[model samples]
Target: MKLDEYLGVIIFTFEHMKDIPVHQLKDRANPAGFEIKYFSPGSMRKEMELLGDDVDDHYLGAHRDDHYLFFLLEKGNASLMIDFQTLPFGKNSLYYVLPGQVHHSIKNEIVYGWFIAVDTMLISTDYRNVFETQLKLQQPHLLDDKQLQQCKSILSLLLEKYDSDVKSSFYIPVVHSLLQSFIGMVACYYSQVNNTGMQLSRPLQLSQQFKQLLGRHIRTIKSPSAYAGMLNVSESYLNEALKKATGFSVSYWIAQEVVMEAKRLLYYSELNVKQIAHHLGYEDHTYFSRLFKKTANETPLEFRAQNRK
Candidate 1:
C-alpha cells in the first residue's frame, strides 16, 4: 500500500493480512497499514466481550496505505487522520476519512469503539455523489463532551442492532435506517461548514436524491446528461462542475462506473453475458458486449473465466 488508495475488504484490513491470490483486495498497492473496517455495534460489543479489554481502548492504528472510513465509538485522546489532516476524534465528536485519507494515533486514554468494513460498492457510490462534499468538510473537529457523548450513544445503539449473532429480517431495515440517519447527520454538518462561508442555492450537484439515484441506477444510466436532467440541471453546467473537481467529464465518469459494475457482474455474479447486458440497460446486447470487450480486452465470458480461475 502507498497513499490515498482505497481498500474495502474486511479481513485484509488487519495490516498483517496477506496478498496471496486468496486475499487480493486489488492488484494495486496502498499505504502499508492504514485500513478501516466497518462493524456493527453488536460486533463491537462482541469484540470487547471477546477481548475482555474495554478499559484498554486507548491505542493507535490507521490505514497502512489507502483511504479508509472509520467511525470510532470510544473516549480518550486518539488522533484520527487521513493524510495531512489529523484531528483528535472519539465518542465526543464525529470523524471521517475520504479516499486516500490516512490516520492513526492513540494517546494514553480509554474508551470503546467498533471497526466497520465499508463495501467498496458503497464507497464508489459515495465517490460519485458525496466524495467532494466530504472532502470539502474534511477537518478533524472537536465536539463538546456532551455532543460527543450523544454521537457515541447513537453509534452504540446502531452497532448493537447490527452486530447481533442471530440475524433477522427486521434487523436489516433497522440497520439501514440507522446508517441513513447517521450519514445524513454527518452530511448536514458538512454542509454547515462548507456551505456557510459562501452559499450556493443552485443546489449541490451531488444532491442526496442524486446520490441515491446514482447508487441505484449507475448501471442502467451511463450519461451525465441523464443524471443532470434527473437533478434538473443542464448538461453543460453539470459537466463543468464535475470536470472542475474530478478531471473527468460527466459521460466519462458515468462510463467508468458502468464499467466497474459490469466487471463485478461479469466476474462475480452468475448472470450470463446477455443477461448482464440487459441488466445494464442495453437493449442491444451486442453493443454492450462490444463495449465490454473494448474496455476490458476480453469477452465477458472470457473475463469471468480468467478471473475466476
Candidate 2:
C-alpha cells in the first residue's frame, strides 16, 4: 500500500500508522499558563460545535502535547493509547500524561471529569519529580473515598477561583496555589503507591539518575562506558548498581530504550527505515536494523507490518 493509504488505516489502527501531531496550549493573552476544563457525556460534542475544527483535531488522531495533561475521571469509562500502550481509565481515577508523550483517545463515553493543561514552568521541581521521574508509566490510580473527597473539594474551590470575576491583585496566585494543592494531593497518592520514599538508597538513586540520563541522551550517547563517565562512576560499578536496582545491566536498558523509541517512531511516523535509523543517531541504517531485529525479535519492516492496525 502507498504511504498515504497506510496513514489513513494506521490513523485509526496500529496497522495503518501515520505521522503523529503535537498539541500545545499556550496563549499570550492567558497569563495564568493553565486551563481547567470539564467534560461530560454531551460536553465534547458541544465543544466541537463551539470550538469548531480545533476541537475535532484534539479528539481524533494520535498526537503529543507540549504541556502536561491531567484528568480526573469521576464517572463512566475512558481509555487512551500512550506511547503505543493502551491504558484503561476507570471512574474515580486520576491519570496524567507527561509532556511530549504521544497519545490519542481510544474511547470516551458518559465521562465526567476535569481536564487540566499546565505549562512545565508552573509545576514545581518536587512535584515534577514525583509525577515525571518517579511515575514513569503514567497510568491511572484509583482514588479512595477520602482521596476522592479531597480532590473534589479542591477542584471545586479551584474551579471557583479559575472562573472568578473579581480581579483582585492575588487572583492568579490564589488560583495557582489551589492548583498546586490539587497537584500535591495527587502526587502524594502516587508517591505512596510507588513507594518512592523521601530518601532513596545510593544504588537506587544512581539507577534513577542513570535512567533519566539514558532517556535524554539515548540518541547521541549509546556506550555503557560513556554513561558511566557521565554519571561519574566506573563501568563495572554502574552495571552493578543498575542490576541491583532494576535487575538489568546498563547495556540491556540502552538497547531497550533504543528499540522502544524506534517502535514508537515506526508505529506513528511516515519516516522510512533509513531516515528513522539516522534520526536515532545511527548512520548505518543496516546496522540499526540488525540491532532492532536482535532486540525486538523482528526486523523493522516486519514489526511495522505486524503491529500497524
Candidate 3:
C-alpha cells in the first residue's frame, strides 16, 4: 500500500481482491466480480504471520475499492476508517463501504466476521438506490438477535456455496441468488433508517439522480445548469430539490466532489498542485488553487505537506 508512487488514488479492483493474502479461496474460482472470505481471530493472526515483514503493505492502509464491500460481525470489536471518518463496530453489527470510497481497517480485536465484496452490476437498481442515495451518512447498523441470526444463517449458506469444490451447472446462478437475498436484507435494514418509506418521492429521486450524475461528471461538467439540462429539469428546480433532499444546492455538492478528489490526489499522489489542478479539469491552476483553499481551508501544497508529515 505504498501511496507515494501513484499519480492518483489507488483503486483496488475485483482482480486485486483475488490477490489478497488473507483471502481463503485462493485456489478456488471466485466467480466473476464477486468474492467472499470468512475471517476469525486465528485466521487474522495466521495471515499476519504469513505476511511477516510485508504485513504492513497488505493491512492497515488506505485505498479505494472499485466494488462494494460489506462486513457482518457476529462478535468481538472492530473499527474502520472510511473517507476520513472512524466507524466503530461491535457485536452483531453490519457495515458497508460504497465503491470508490477511501477506507482502511482501523482495528480488529478477536473478530469473527464475513467480508463480502460484489460488483455494482450485481446489486439490483433498487438496492443500489438505497445504498447510494437514500442514506445520508452510512454507519454501523446494529442488528437485533433475530436479524443477526437471519444474517448468520444466510451467510453460512453462502459460505458453503462459496467454499464448495463441486461446481454444478447452476453454481453461478445459485450463488448469485444467495447474494441477492443477503443484499436485500441489508437494503431493507438501511431503508428503515432512511424513513423514506417504500416509495421514494420525486424530488428525492431527482436529488439522488443529480448526486449520481455529479459523481460521474464532476470533472467534465461543472455548472448546475448543465446538469439540469442533462437531467431535463430546470436549474432552479434542481437546486430546490437538492436543497430539500440534501440541505445543499447542486453547486455546493459539485464543489465538494471536486475538493474531495483534490484531497485524495494531494495526499496519495506525487503530482504537484498545477498538475493536480489540471488533472481535476481546471485549465487555470490559480483558480483551482483558490477553490481548493476556499473549500479545504488550505492551499494544495500545504495540505500535501501536512498530510505527508
Candidate 4:
C-alpha cells in the first residue's frame, strides 16, 4: 500500500480499537487529549475470531503511526517488527513503539496484552525521554512476575477510570496521574533491566542532561563542546561521562542525533537535501551530505526515497 493509505489504516485502527463505541467518546469530547484501549485475553480472542483470516493478512503488514504505543503482554507470545528489527516477545514482557516507527504485529499465539497509545503532547518530557533515549539502546524488558502484576494492576485502574461513566472536572487529572504512574513504572523497569544494577551517578546524570540539551539545541548548536559548555562542564569531562553512561562518545551522539533529524525531515517534509542541510545548521550542503552518508550508509536523497512511507 501507499504511505497515505497505510497511514489511514493506522488511524482507523487507533480510533476503533477501544472497547467502547467511538461515537460515545467523540460526543463527550475526550478531555485528556489521548485515547486508552484495554484488551483482555477474552476480548482479544473474540476480536481475533471475528477478524478470522483478515487478522493474518492485514495485521501482519507493516504500517506506521503518529502516536506513541506502550504494550504490556501478560500472557502468550507474539513477534513484532519495529523499523527493520524483528523482535519476538513472550509472556510477561513490555515493549514500546515510538511515533514514526514502522512496525508490524508479525504473528500472535493467543496473545493477551494491553496497549495504550498517547499523543506526544500528553506525555511528560521526562517519560518521553526514557523511551526516546534509553529504550532505543535496550531491548524490551522481560518483566518479572511481580513487575507484571504491578503493571497489570496499574493498567486495570487506568481502564476503570477510562471507562467511567461520570465525567467530572477531576476525570482528566485522575487519568493523567494514572497514565504517568504506569509510564513511570515501565521506565523504572526499563532502566533497571538495561543498567543491570548500575547505580545512578554524577556522570550518568550529566549524560542525561547533555542528551536533553542536545535534543533542544541540535538545530543551532552542532558542536559537542558547546553542549558541554551549556551543561557547565568541560568537553573532556562531558565526553567521559557520556562514554561511561552510554558507551558512545559525545561526537558520535551529536552526529547520530543530527543524522536522525535529517532523516526525519527528508522522509516527512518536502525539503530537498540542501534545504535540509541548511535547516540542520550545516553551511556546506556537500559536507552535510557526506556526513549523512557516513553515518547512515546512504545519501540524503537515497534515504528519503527509501523511507518515504
The sequence of per-residue lDDT tens digits that candidate 3 reaches over residues 1-309 is 121111122234322332211222222327645777777756545434443442343233466666678888887887676655678888988988777676666565677777888877889888888888742458888999999999989988988987776366777888888989999999999889776445888788897788778777877889999999999999999999988888888888888889887876676556778888888899999999999899889998888788666
lDDT of 3 at 225: 98
Question: Comparing 1 and 2 by lDDT, which wins?
Answer: 2
Write one digit per residue (lDDT tens) for candidate 2, span 164-242: 7637778888999999998888788888877665676777777778877887898899999999999999999999988
Candidate 1 shows a clash count of: 31
Error of 4 at 88 (Å): 3.6
Model 4: number of backbone collisions: 0
Candidate 4 lDDT: 0.68
Better of 2 and 4 by TM-score: 2
Candidates ranked, most accurate by lDDT first = 2, 3, 4, 1
Q: Write the per-residue lDDT of candidate 1 for residues 172-278, one digit (tens) a residue.
A: 56765665565555555555655521343344444444444555687667777789898788888777766665465667656655665566555434677788778
Q: What are the RMSDs of all candidates, in order?
A: 12.5, 5.5, 5.6, 7.2
1 or 3: which has the higher TM-score?
A: 3
lDDT of 4 by residue, 172-281 (tens): 88988998898888777766655622355777677767876776688899888898889899999988988888898899998988887776566434677888899889
Judge candidate 2 at residue 229 and give its lDDT: 97
Q: Model 2 TM-score? A: 0.85
In model 4, which range of ten residues has the least summed lDDT? 1-10
Model 1 lowest lDDT segment of ten:
1-10
True lDDT of residue 75, candidate 4: 74
In angstroms, give how far residue 186 of model 3 lies from its true place. Answer: 0.2
Q: Which one is best on lDDT? A: 2
